[model samples]
Target: REKEEDGLETSPSKAECSVWEDLTLEKARLELNENPDTLHQDIQEVRDMVITRPDIGFLRTDDAFILRFLRARKFQHFEAFRLLAQYFEYRQQNLDMFKSFKATDPGIKQALKDGFPGGLANLDHYGRKILVLSPSIIDRYTLVDILRAILLSLEAMIEDPELQVNGFVLIIDWSNFTFKGWGLGSLAGSSGAEQDGPVGQMWLAGRNLPMSDVEALYANIPHKDVLQAVRNSIPDTITANLVAELCDFVLIHSYFRFGDNLYLQIGRTAMGTHMAPQYANIFMADLEQRFLSFCPLTPT
Candidate 1:
């Protein structure tokens, strides 16, 4: 059976058999809500959606490729379809990043050599792969190249079935990182108390939270919610309405320069802004307060 599946005339060795068995066991443990009996149907359903959507462009409709998105979204066909479209759309919009998206690409190779996203050989207790990043290296390379390196690493790692099922963790070391490196020199130059206020506290707290959590919070944050969070955090001497208006302006009209073109940021907060960190921290704190009030017994 293994020989047939693997397209080999000879039987797989003991090590290969053991690895397959381990992956099967790990899949069972992860329980991504994927029903083996219905998995083919699920994959077919998503593939069918992809076929009908001309806007997403020609995508790899192979079982393995579709299955990765399914597992990531717990086999929800619609959500997986949406993710598939976004995946292609992102690549389309950022042609430069994906142009030579390979480990050997000069820019990517340099970033990898600089340890932009260093990968660990060992897996976590959940059998998930771990990747580490050091922010201090950002100053040495363009952000696009760093992102390419990280994407290349993830693309290579995701080929493992166990990693697809269990996922991965990213560890970012902020040691020796400076505000200037993060494009926040203005904030760094502020008074000590201001520099160490909510933004500083959130930066410390963020180290403990999963990157996905932070991303999800910011991606789906309503403007009104952010305004309310800002309202609650500002000094009484400041006019709440005026601050709220300023916050709205920042959120609605945020833009950034990439290469020779300027791009407006949508969905999430603008990257590398002094106010961005504070807004995120304030909103996160508001969420925690709400959660605590709703569930008093839950540990902080």
Candidate 2:
């Protein structure tokens, strides 16, 4: 009461200041510190650069649309351009899916009804959207159709301001799933027109993506290094070779332990390009089945 009578202005408490600092740190980690005006200018620059680039120009060049690719490439203009180009090229190749695609489209609707992939309306603690896929329930839709659903869902999510900066988390529940088709014999072969089926096509589409859109992969379970140790102790040579090869594809670049999770950063190539974004999806699908095999034993 005496302090108030002396007319001293109230200041925020130390706890409040600490909370503010934490929030700032979180925002910076998510790259949310970008100034709105500056970001808009950057988007405009890219739009102008690609405004007359043939097939790419036909795409919606609004800031919202362009920002997705830019965000995917960490605002790298040329990398974003390459991704944007690849995206359009994919769309062009699959005219039936892209020409008149809709969230309410029959194929997507049926897939949704069958629960091929489902999305949670809630955001993660980091404000990123949550998307879940159940591989076991993927019987109704073609692989291309499934990809289209995912891409379309992502397009819708990118429009949200929260998801724009924070991105999204994809969780695939592989419970009761089986690795069908290509057994060990066929997986080793690198070339064959006959091998190009749904899974193969999906892998090819993923491989075709420019190595700029991926950031890093986060595995929030057991330690990958420990998993590696146990995997080395396995007796079966062929199984060991398959697991090792798959691990090489999934756990590339540097790995750091954060609590129980292992964060695997994508290495930049000599020519300065990141790894393909599709590696995460492809890896997760295979990893789940492999993970089940070595659950009590060790991760494959």
Candidate 3:
């Protein structure tokens, strides 16, 4: 400890003193004061320049806390949170990107044509979708994951016949319209498909849901003819791939967004999407008829 403290005068060090040894303490103190005064004068000059110049920017460090304090005392109207959000977006370049898009994108230009034109409506649509999805509450990623998880659960059902989720089954009325073939089934687009396609039944959550129960549910549930409609949506060859993609998007959206949040709300009645609901029915049927266990895939 003594060896390490050799140069510390505060600790009674004995290191050799240099040039300052010949100067009086008063002279040294005076010189140090002079430098500090010079620094203060320089700072004042810049401060004065900033006050007079409109192009200069000033510190925001104390702005928020100060405003908040004033607000607490009920002095004038000040919305700190909104200001903070704007400030951060500006600082972080988020708002700048939005502005850039409005300035450069053709879509944005078309959207804003004249005095309060469709641009307002477009903004409304944006807000409407957010409100419908309630993304702020649930978020986009979680909704997508929910759909994936539902698929995993169904896969589990198929993989292990013994591992059923309460013996659930869904029934849909089918008159054995064996008239329908690969080209005739529901043409659910990307969102409706299950794993690679749609997979679900209406009553899969109920107790003692056997295949018979599923058939009963289908037989009992209200519906309409879909084959003719499906045929017209797309040609047979590409319909399969389209159906697969659409089905995936739909099932994932609904399964994931069982509840709504700004981050993840899909449009009303996920079934309304061209082929999502019907495809979902087919997917559920596949799950009950083919797969065994309905657990997520886990690494061994």
Q: Considering every candidate listed, which one attains the maximal lDDT? A: 1
Which portions of model 3 miss their true places by more than 4 Å? Answer: 1-82, 85-87, 90-96, 99-105, 114-300
Q: How accurate is candidate 1 locally (lDDT)?
A: 0.75
lDDT by residue (1-300, candidate 2, tens digit) is 123667874565778657745664466345634455578887877777675567553457777788777777777787787788787877777787785577788777777666556788655776667888887655445776787777777777677654666667889998866433321113334443433444554453223211123244433323354245335545687786676566556545556677999865654211121332333444455555566777684322
Among these predictions, the greatest TM-score belongs to 1
Model 1: per-residue Cα lDDT over 224-252, one tens digit each: 89899888777773787789899888898
lDDT scores of the candidates, listed in order: 0.75, 0.60, 0.32
C-alpha RMSD by candidate, in order: 17.5, 15.8, 29.4
Output the worst ten-in-a-row residue range by lDDT, candidate 3: 125-134
Q: Which of 2 and 3 is ahead in TM-score?
A: 2
Q: TM-score per candidate, in order?
A: 0.57, 0.50, 0.17
Candidate that beats the other on lDDT, 2 or 3, i.e. the better one:
2
The pairs that clash in candidate 2 are: none
User: Cα RMSD (Å) between model 2 and the true structure?
Assistant: 15.8
Q: Which ten residues in a row have the lowest lDDT in candidate 2?
A: 205-214
Task: Give the Å error, residue 213, model 3.
Answer: 20
Candidate 3 lDDT by residue in tens digits, 83-114: 43344445455433333433234433332222
